[model samples]
Target: MSPRQRDRVRSLVADSEAPIDAQTVAAELSVHVTTARFHLNNLVEEGSAIAINLPPIGVGRPRVGYRLVVAPPVDDLMLMLVARLGETPEQREELAAEVGRAWAAKHLPSVAIDAELVPDPVVLAETILTRLGFRITDVVSAFGQHEITLCGCPLEKIEHELPEVARGVVRGLLETALTAGSPALAAQYAVAVRPAPGGKCELRLNLAQVADSTAR
Candidate 1:
């Protein structure tokens, strides 16, 4: 089977609100039932998806269903905020950053700021991104800045459709994480999301020159 087809099947499982059976997968992809089952089983074996017993629909035996092992939580509030907040794209993105900040504060681990302890922003970034189901590809340090490349965003669909808002979300998450660790260092750095060579996105942290700025 083609890798793209398998990825599509995985995406279908990730996007669905309810568990999907082989029959449903076959119908959706217009593939044979055996082919669908094969892909679903492969996903289960690979630990990306799981098989579960679905509720019986007036039948003798319950059907088995496939679902993502770690399905990303749907953010209906983000959509509502997007629709109600702003008239223009820029306004929406600006407001969305606030929403993202609040989200990161709630979801990310609480940090105890210590004056003596210097926090590594990249570590905090990895913690938050991994918790949010993003796959980080590479982290490069150059020119007094660090660039983190990531793919397989949990909110891939939303990121694709609302790029401005997506950028806001990413920006807020990074900024808030940095601030929690060290307000001084946070002020010295700026976060920007840029497109990478492949489908990956880069989180570039631009450091501004300020002597002893990180020292507390």
Candidate 2:
């Protein structure tokens, strides 16, 4: 989420007469429901809002609603620095991704790959996440899909303020590691970031459609 996007979400929450649900936010902002929910959850984590169980109107479960609250004091130095990086939001995001790539490249191991010692992308991703101060709480895999749930991001502040960059860091880390050890796996799967509550996120490795001979 960019600062602009977050501000819009905040404004929506602030202006609503009643607590707003993520569906309403998504409709108002013209964003995906998941995107709206991610920001809403982030706001709750930041103490800018509170989640309440709304009275059930008609159905199976009560909708979760978000209500505005007094936000805690925030440090703006990092945001100020990010503003100076680029003239536009897209430029800043790209620059941030480059920084992520550089950071990953610097810290990742440089062991030469051998035919008998191919590195597993999931294992390498976990190692990188650990180095970045993330705690892996759950990992599930079946068939070709793999999911890693991480808690306690060291870049929580950055994630709240500039989520694109935070996502870029995750992407760059896995990408660098995958390309280094197993380009085949790199071509076979792509990693994605799924935001969750309490400064946590899910890293999903979705298998990409490729030729049978390519992934080998």
Highest TM-score among the candidates is held by which one? 1
**Residue 14 of model 2, lDDT score:** 96
lDDT at residue 122 of model 1 (Cα atoms): 79
- Estimate candidate 2's RMSD in Å: 18.2
Residue-wise C-alpha lDDT for candidate 1, range 1-216, written one tens digit per residue: 689998889988899999999989999999998999999999999888889998888957898899888645556655665666678768867876887788788888765789777677778778877877777788887665777877736656656666677777777777788788777668667777755555644333333334565442
Candidates in order have lDDT scores of 0.75, 0.74
Task: Please report, as a residue range, the 10-residue window in candidate 1 with the lowest summed lDDT.
Answer: 200-209
Clashes of each: 0, 0
Please give the lDDT score at residue 59 for candidate 2. 75
TM-score of each: 0.56, 0.54
Model 1 error, position 103 (Å):
1.2
